[model samples]
Structure formats: C-alpha cells, structure tokens
Target chain A: MRLKHLLASVAMSATVLAATGAKAVEIEYWQYVFETRVKAMDQLIQKFQAANPDIKVKQTTFPYADYQTKVAASIMAGQGPDVVQLFYGWTDNFISGKMIQPLRASAFPAADIERDFFPIVSAMKRGNDYYGLPTAVRSLALFYNKKIFKDAGLDPANPPKTLDEFVAAAEKTAKRDGGGNLTQAGVTMDMTGQDHQWWREVLIRQNGGQPYTDNDSKVAYNDEAGLKALTFYIDLQKTKKVGQVGFMDEGQAAFRGGLAAMTIDGTFRLGSFNTIKAFEWGVTELPANAKGERSNYASYFANAITTKAQGEKLAAAEKFLAYISSPEAMKVWLEVVGELPARRAAALTPENLANPIYGPFLKGLEYAHTTEFKDEMAQRQVAIDMVNRVLIGGETPKDSLAKAATAEQAILDRAAKR
Target chain B: MSATGTEAAAGGLWSRLSLSQKQVLWAWAFLAVPVLFYTVIRFWPTVQAFYLSATDWNVMRPASYVGFENYRRLWSDPLFWQVFRNTFAYLLLGTPISLLLSFVVAYYLDRVRFMHSFIRALYFLPFLTTAAAMAWVWRWFYQPVPIGVINDILATFGLPQQPFLRSTTQALPAVLAPAIWAGLGFQIIIFLAGLRAIPSTYYEAARIDGLSEGAILRKITIPLLKPTLVFLVVFSSIGFLRIFDQVYNINSNDPGGPLNSTKPLVLMIYQTAFSSYEMGYAAAQTVVLFLILLVISLVQLRIMRDR
Candidate 1:
C-alpha cells in the first residue's frame, strides 16, 4: 500500500511540472545599469507580466562601461539575453556581428515606423528592415545656472540666443583670481565629453559646413567652414579666456558644482540635474549663428531582439519589444528617465511642449541630426584628438582640421571595406 | 559478486607488474589533473591565439586566412608604435622606481618596534584596495586649483598649477605614480621577509668589524637579498610591462587619451579586440606582446642568474 501511494504522488508531481513548463515562456531582457532606466524597466516588466500571464521576463543589467563587452562575450557563448538594449550607434556593428535579427515587418512595418516616429529613427534602418526601436530620444541644449546669471548681473530670464550674445555673456560672467586662474568659468570646455558632439554637429553645421557627405561615409569637414568652427571652439579658451580646460576635470561636474555659468549637455542629464536642490537651473536652445540658423545632435539607446531568441521565446520577445516601444511605455520612460518620447504623437503633445524645463530640448528635436556612425567610439576619439592637437599640442586649427579629416576618412574607409 | 571478481582480476594484473612500474603508474595518476588543467585552460588558448593571429576573425563573420596582413598592418600603424613606447616607459621607469622605494621603506621599517604592525598595515592598505577605487582618488588629486589637493598645495607654495593628467608630457608619469604606489606594499612585504631571513649574527660581526651603515647595506644586506631582488625584478618587470588597470581607470573619460599619450600595448589590444572587434588584429598584437614578455623575462633571468 505504501509503494502504491509513493507511485501516485510521483506521477502527480510530474504532471504539475509538465503543466508549468508548457504554460509559461520565459525570456531575458538586458540593459545597462542606469538607476532610473532600471527602475523604469522593472515597472514596465511588472505591468507586462500582469497583462500577459503566460510569459515571464527576466531583467539583467551591467555597468555602462562593461555592458558592450559583457553582451558580446555572453552572446558569443550562445547563452545571453533574448532582448538586449544597445546604443543606436552600435546597430551596424550588431547587424554585422549577427548579434541581433531584423524585426519582422508584420510586427513592425517600415512605413508605420517612419510615419509615427521622428525621422531620426531611420538611423536604425538598413535596406527596409529595422533592427531595433527606441523608447526615447535625446538631444543637446544649453544648461544654465539661473542663480549664477543673477549674481553676474544678467537677467536670468534672458539667456543668450545668438553666438555673439553667448560669448559676451560668458565673458561678463567669468570670474578670475589674482593668479589669472578662473575662480568661476563662463562656460565649460571638455572635448572628451559632449563638446565633441556640440562642435561637430552644431558648430560646423551653423558655420555652413557639412561634417560628412557621400551618404555619411566620407569626411567633408576639412573645408573653410570647418576651420572657422574649430577656431571658434579653441578661442573660447585661448582668446576669450572665459573658461579653461581641465578646470574641474569634467564639464558637467563644473556646471553641477556651480562653477560654470553655462554648459551644453544632452536631455539625459535632466534626471540627475532635477535631483540637485542647491540652485535652480534652466535649459535653452543652443545658440544660433548670425543668420538665426540652429543645429543639434540627437541620439538614443534602442532595444532589439537578439539572434538567440527562437520559436516561443522569439514570440515572447516580439511582444516585449512591441510593448516597450508603445506610446504608453514611451510616456512612462519620459516621466521616469527625462528623455523625450521617440514618436511625434507621444512627444509633441501640448502639455509636453509647454513644459519650461523640457521645452528647449523638445524644440531641439526638430532640427537635430543623428550621425550614422560606423564605429562611434573610434569616431569620437578622432574628434577628441583633433581638438587636443590645437589646444595642447599648439598646432594650427587649419592643420588640425585637415589631419582630422584624413584620419576620420581612413576610419570610414576601413569600416566600409569590412 | 561482480566487485570481488573485478578485484581478483586487477590483483592478478597488479601482481605481475614490477615495483618501479607501480611507482611510475602512481606518478602518472598524480600528474594527470594539472596536465589536463593546463592543456585546457592555458596552453590551448595560447596555441589558438597563434593560429587566430593569421586569420581575419571579427567574431561576427567566419574567419578567413589573412596571413601576415595583420602583422604588416601593425608594423605600419603609428598608434601601435606609440603604445609600444608607452609600455616600455612603464617597465623601464616603474620597475626601478618601485623597487627602490619599497626597499628603502622595508629596510628602515625592519628595525622599528613601536607601532610597527600598524604602520606596516597603513603602507599595505593601498595594495589591498581595488585599483579602480585607488585610481579615482588619484584622479581627484590631479584636478586643478580649487578642487585638487596637489594643486591646492602648489598654490600655497606660490608655485604655478600643474596640468598633471591633462598634459601629454605629465600624464604618463602622473598615471605611473599611483601604479608604483599600489605595488609598493606587496614589494615592501617581500623585502621585509627577505631582510628578516638574514642572520643577525652577520650584523653583529659587521659592527665588531666597525663597518659603516652604508657599507653594511651595500655589502651585507644587499648581497644576502640577491634571491629576493632577482625574483622581484622579474616579477615587477612583468607587472609593469602589462600595466592596464590604473591607467585605464584614471582619466577614464579618455583611457590612454590626450592624443593616445598614456595608451599602453595592452589597452591597444583591448580596444582593437573589443571596441573595434578586430579579433585577428588583436591576436597578432597579443602574439607580439607574448614574445616581448618572453624575451624580457628570459633575458632578466639569464642576467640575474649569473650574478
């Protein structure tokens, strides 16, 4: 009788395990570990699981610095996330590496994506197949400390709108000690940071120069306009003396510490900046050229389904990707992460456009250019070296610009060959 | 019943074997684990690297034989040469300076009795700390004017502020300083152990002979510490040659940046492999580094072993 009882129980437990194994499809989602982004993803996951009871999503995060390396190593080993978050700049690399698969047109139609989302989202497109979708987008704007402006005797409400006015305000607000070292800077200059983007996308465009041509595959920034743009950037330190490089080591740090009056940063900084209660800050559109033409650089982190997902897991991943890229998820991402929604309908609402802190950045999206980078890190390093040559190496701007163009052209050529 | 049958069969075979053969079997059993481990873990990957070095394996596409192309590219690459110089700079300067500093501290600290362990712990604290954390602290120290401790001290002394990490000329040394400091603790401990192993009677005999302190250090302590010195020289030379962590972390905004002034060979290999995903090219660089390390170590051993 006891043997019969054990047999019955064992059969019952097997049935229960089989039932669960059939009912649920589990997929892993991965992203870099930014506090707000992780929190937002968790909330999204909770909502997703509740609505789709048959699917379970597991979330994994790695530090931003190590995220790419971790993703590559794990995927190469054939065990990693089904859905992974990647920088839009890395979409090409991912496609070439076979790390991710293109989204099915039935699930994500190319025409619908182009009509609904901002035009910049097309950076993820290659031959009518989209590899990824972004929940939010980021663009550059000038962040100014209102308290510093007031102390410097400039109207806090009247921020600079033109390049000449911007430089004038910077010079007026800058404070220097007896040693001629700036005690407080008018602006922060860090080539290693977003300054490279500001110079390449905004300054060069405003100066009537195209940074790249030939389908964004060739260097065209070696012209006269490029020389002018580079010179303007260098003179901010050498001639204007309004700010110094390496003054607090980082540009954002100087602005955060209230030592700099103005800094050009991206919309992603909004979440962190909102946390600081020491002083109030305001965002404004980047200063325009003499002709009132403005430019900005836009970028985003996108989510894609990796090649590892198949059959049931692939179906679940498709559902998860669609849900996250929906208007509702974009709204949640905007509220929590301070990045703009990718879709025009979701981002261009009346209330969102009128928001004082977000208005300037939202306006910047209309004219922003998304650089189609072959290798974003390598390209950024080229821009950095270009600036350093003029600033530290004491080279001429014309020479530096020519050298940079040649170097960047070589990188692009090499990438094209691959 | 089956176990007894098998045991009886094994015993019949074992009884026929000679004593030396039995001992040889035991030794083979003992050697198998480590041999298997090294084959799988160390030597296999090394051999694969040599093979992969001649192929164009970008991790995404299937590998194709590119023989000598990667080596030829590395030969003409200016950045590789710069990194080569930076790596040698770390070895030539870092090894000697770190050795001297650790020896000095260990030599003096050996005689101290008051709060000795506490002081020794303080010196060793940096070694135990993570390189990432220690590098960040040093980065902060190199910041300018109102933020940096070093610059603040410079201001007090009426000296001009130095652009330590920002300047290409100074960034290498600035990075090397913390690396040398971090290794000092371990080197000092080794030196202390070596110093303690020396007989106290030799020192007493030296005192009786009226040898000066300088003479005692030069003749007695120096000669007795030869083994320790040789080991440390080779060990630290290897350490300095492959220096990555401190340089990578300090000024992380641009690791080996400001025009690649502080970039070392290891960092270049890392970028080429991971960032650019040029696995074959990275493998070629790795083979070069392996040869360099092998040659340096062998040379060091040969020179030191003779003297």
Candidate 2:
C-alpha cells in the first residue's frame, strides 16, 4: 500500500509534465545509420519523446557515405542542427577554444564523464572547456570460418596468432578450380575510402613500429615499418599465392556464398554475416604482428554543439546531451544500435560485457590504435589513395607516402586557415 | 447621363485588355509556378556556388572572404593540370569515335525504311538507363580476369585476356567504351532525324550522274549531315569534359588510379571539395575549370555559327 502511494505520486508528476503544452521545444540532431539500426533509432527517438514531455527531438539521418560532407555544409550555412554527430577527431577543427560550449558542469559531473569515456583515452589536451561528447565506440576485427580451420587440420578454436601464421593459414586454405584460375581467395587487402581495411594501418603499428609517431604529425609509418608491413601485404598475392590478384571486396559475393573460409571487416558487419545462413562462422582477433601484439583500428562517433547553437538553444542542447550521454541513453545506443557502448559504466554491465557474441569487441578495444593523421578527413582520402597508388601504381611505398604527405599537408594547411 | 457615360469611357484602359492578351497572360500565370520552381532549384544553387567559391571555407567553420586567392592557387596546381589533360584526352578520342559510329549506324538504319523505327528504339534503350546502374554492369564486364565474360569469350578463341580497366594502358579506353555505348544511341537518333529530313532528290541526282554507292554517300549525305556532325561534336565535347559519374562508378577503388589514368578535371574538383573538405582549393579548381570549359564552348559556338 505504501509503494502504491509512492507510484501514484510519481505518475501524477509525469502527468503534470505532460499537460504543460503541445508543441514542446523541438531540437534537431543529425546522425549516420542504416538497415536495422535505423529502425532501432526510430524506436529510441519515440521513447525519448515520451520520457521528456516538454522536449521534442527531430532526427535526421544519412548514410555514412555522405554524412560528413553533409554535416559540414549544413554547419557552414548557419542552419545546422542544434546537436550534431561527428567522428572523434573532427572536434578539434570546431573547438578552437571558441564556439560550442563545454558540457554543463552543473548538470553532469565532468570528471566522471571524462574518466568513464573511451574517447578520453586518446585525447591529447585536457581542458575544462569541452567541445565534443561521444556516445559509442567500436573497433575492427578479423572473421574466420571454423569449418575450414578444422578441414585444414588446424585447431578451429585457435586461429592464426602472428602475421606469418596468417600467411601460412591463408596459403593452406586457398584453392584454384579445375581451370588454372582462382575460384577461392584467402584474403582481400583492397583499400579505399569505402569498405577499406583498417587492419593494414593497425598491423604496421603492431609489427614493432607505429603508423604515426611524433604526436601524429609525421609520416613515420611510411618508412621501414611501412615497407615491411606493405611488402607482407603485397607478397601475399605476388609471391605467397595466398591472396588473389585484383580480387577486391565487390568480387567477394562468392565468399559470402561460402567460397572462402575467412574475411576481415568491422564489427558493424557482424549483423550482416548473421544473415549468411549457408556457413557456420565465428569471430576472432585479427592476426598479431611479428612482435606478438594483436592490435586493431578504432574510430568514434562524437556529438558536438555547433557554433550556430548558442544561448538558450545551447542550454537546451546541453540538457538533451546530458540525457543522451547518460548511462541509460548509451545502453539504448549499444543494444539497439548494435554499437559497443562508449561509457565505462554502460560497458561494465554484465549483459554487454558477457554476451558471448560481442565479448571479442570488448576485448579488442583494449588493443585498438588510431590512424596517424590528425586531420581525419584529409588523410583519410589522400592516405588511402596513396595505398591504392602503391598497390596499382607499382610506385614504391616510400615515394607514394611522401607524395601523399605533400597533398595531406596542403589540405591540413588549407583547413587550418578557417 | 452624359457625365456618367464619359466617366465609364475614361476608365476604358482597364477593360481594354483583349481576350488574346488575357489568354497569353493566363498561360504565363500557369508557367509562373514551374518557372519559380526551376529558378529556385537550379539557378539559385548556381548563384550560391559562385558566392561560396569566393570564401575560405571548409563547409564547417565560419566562411571568410578570400578574394581571388583560390583562383590564384589553382593556376599553379600541377594535379589540376593533370586532370585537365586527362579530360581533354578523353574528349579528343571519345568524341570523333562517337560521331563516326553514330553516322554509320544512322546510314544503315535509314536504308531499311520498314525496320527503321523499331531498330532506332532498340538501340536507344541503353541511353534511357541511369549511369550508376550501367557503370556497375560494365565494371564487371571490364574485369581483367580470364573468368570475366568478355575475357572468357576471348579466351575460348585462343585470344589473350585483356586488362580492360585494371591496367594503366587500358583503363581510360575501358571507361570510354560505356560512354560510347550510352552516347552513340543519342547521336544516332539525332543523325537519323537529320537524315530523314534530308531530301532524297540529291541521292537520285547522284545516281543519274553515274555515281557509285560510296560516291553518293560522299557527295550527298556527307555534305547534308555536316551541320549535324559539327553540332554533335561540340555538344559531346561539353558533355565529355564534365565526365564524372561513369568514371567514378566504373572503378570505385580509384577513378584515376593505376597512376592517375582516368581522373577527369570535374571529378577531381568534386573530390577536392566534398571528399577532401578543401572548399577553397576546390573553388580555385572550379574557376579555372570554368574558364577552360568556357573557352572551348565559345570557340565551338563561333565556328558553328560561321558554318
């Protein structure tokens, strides 16, 4: 009876909040999502509307292919959303110590938020003035076929541990059909802005070297470490006969049709592979470097209040952020969006940490590395193009990277002026 | 009564608008919506692009006035020059080939009056499809592997499998094949229309004068189709200079990859602007590209008018 009385009082307050008015203060947020995740976002937004009766959120979404440019253009036009989503590294450009307010010190504990977020791990400059807030994080991983491993007489439970082991394993699994042409490929190392493998970047760092050194301003990875790493990648096809020449990702529909026994991709693709009913599959760590370290590449999805969003709109934006970045909102983000949670508290919950399907992701995050380029958008294009040049241009890796650095520096200098 | 009639007569100009004039006004009234729609959707963006190109902007931060510095920088960019060279190379090779192929098809189609309409529509089908969809269908077709269909058929006859798009030597030609495929049909249709409009008297006169089949074509048809040929060449040049969607989709790995073999000037500008987020540099590229395109278009127009 006493519990019923307390529930009744709470319900009355909720009702009073609801009766405040129609046309509540509406805020817009732009994010990137697709497929089942988009549906999950719709449901999550609906729930938020119900919880906060006086605040409404109008959501806009675009595919990852065009979201960055779209957001950048919108912000410049002075008509961007009240709250916007970005990649982790993009915050530096907008923050510049002006524009975008810090996380509300009164509404949320800044110390706790910083200590609990994975993005803070890689942040260089700590400050009382924060411009970026992240909601979820993830890293790339290698996927292999259990049936193929058992057929090769290797332990299905233990995949390749080192880069050499991976090469040997791949060579063993690859096969050509009756005609003297490739029918099954062991791996694909194609790099582009789209569906490009981040494994290559991480492997260089793990192979007793780093992709970026000197606070990420130098192209340190393009030297001996880069040559060793790339030679290993190229020789997989050119000499080792493990990877097929010109066998890009688009040609891998056959792989999903159960042609190859292994593939490397991001955690986001696990849901898609779940639909491949033909083959029994399992997840594992990416192959380790010669130094016996297995590291993968990671990037984050962050939200920053735009320069256009200030005053009451900025205050409202912070309140919405406080709600969205709370442990509760992040849970909805991870479970519903298929993203690994960014907050430590949200991630520590046993349901996320112990879920056998995603436990590898939690473990993989510990060894993840970021790319060496500071200006994320610039190097992302020029650097990837340099890799393609090395692969197809037949230019030595060192020359290609030096050329890319020239182009990347030009882009960085241009971006810095604004 | 006299004063009242005079007052009514004095207001005559208001009612003097005739039915024909009113009907024309009503037609313009109906067109106002479409005109407004086109102005806002098309012309507004062009104006906006021009204004935005004058600023040092990343499309993220506050835009600042940068005068003509963007244009100054583009003048010195070597990569921009390379892209321009690629675009011109594609145009020089791709345009004449389009004209000759369409002329041959148009002449043959015109010979068979019974099947002319049916064959024309049949060949025109590819032009109606979107470039993106066509590019993918062709990307697989251009695969260098012997397993690819084109190579498979070639291999069956003991011919070597050509690297249709994967090779630095072959990538540009491979990309141009689809443009030729998509473009030939339109030129063929236009040439066919021009052929139909040509009077048959000239062909009959050549035959009476003892001209051979080849002679009649050389003397009568070539002279008559000269105008259409020039127009087709100039129009196709403008279209090919802006080559992007086909090159972009043909090989997403690198449009100008295999050592910058296929990058068109316009596509590079697009990459610099949206893909790289260097709006100032992209604008400089645009202004320079605009001048090149403008010069080509003006020269073509001047020659066409003189002809």
Candidate maximizing TM-score: 1
Index of the highest-DockQ prediction: 1
lDDT of 1 at A152: 88
**Candidate 2 lDDT tens digits, B1-307:** 3567765885676367888987887799799999999999988876767776788777656678888877777768777777778899889989888888988998898888897778999889889989888988888776644346786676667566676676776889888889888988899999998898889888788788999999888878888877887789788998898888899998776656555678898888887777667676677677677777899888887876645
| lDDT over C-alpha atoms for residue A138 of model 2 | 71
Write model 1 residue lDDT over B1-307, tens digit each, in one string. 3567766879988889999999999899899999999999999999999999999987766689999999999999999999999999999999999999999999999999999999899999899999999999999999988889998888778788888998899999999999999999999999999999999999999999999999999999999999999999999999998999899999788889778999999999999988888899999999999999999999998888844
**DockQ (CA atoms), all models:** 0.42, 0.24
- Candidate 1 per-residue lDDT, tens place, A1-418, comes to 6678889999999999888878899999999998999999999999999999999999999998788778877887898999999999888777877899999999899999999988888889888899999999999999999999999899999999999999998998898867776778899998877998998889999999989997689998999889999999999999999888787989999999989999999997876787878899898999999999999999999999999999999999999999999999999999888889998899999999999877888889889999988888788889889988888899999999999999989899988887
The reply for model 1, stretches above 4 Å from the true place, is: A1-18, A21-28, A45-66, A69-82, A307-320, B1-32, B113-115
Docking class of 1: acceptable
Q: Chain A vs. true chain A, TM-score per candidate?
A: 0.93, 0.81
Of the true interface contacts, the fraction found in model 1 is 0.50
- Clashing pairs in model 1, backbone N/Cα/C closer than 3 A: none
Local accuracy by lDDT, each model = 0.91, 0.71
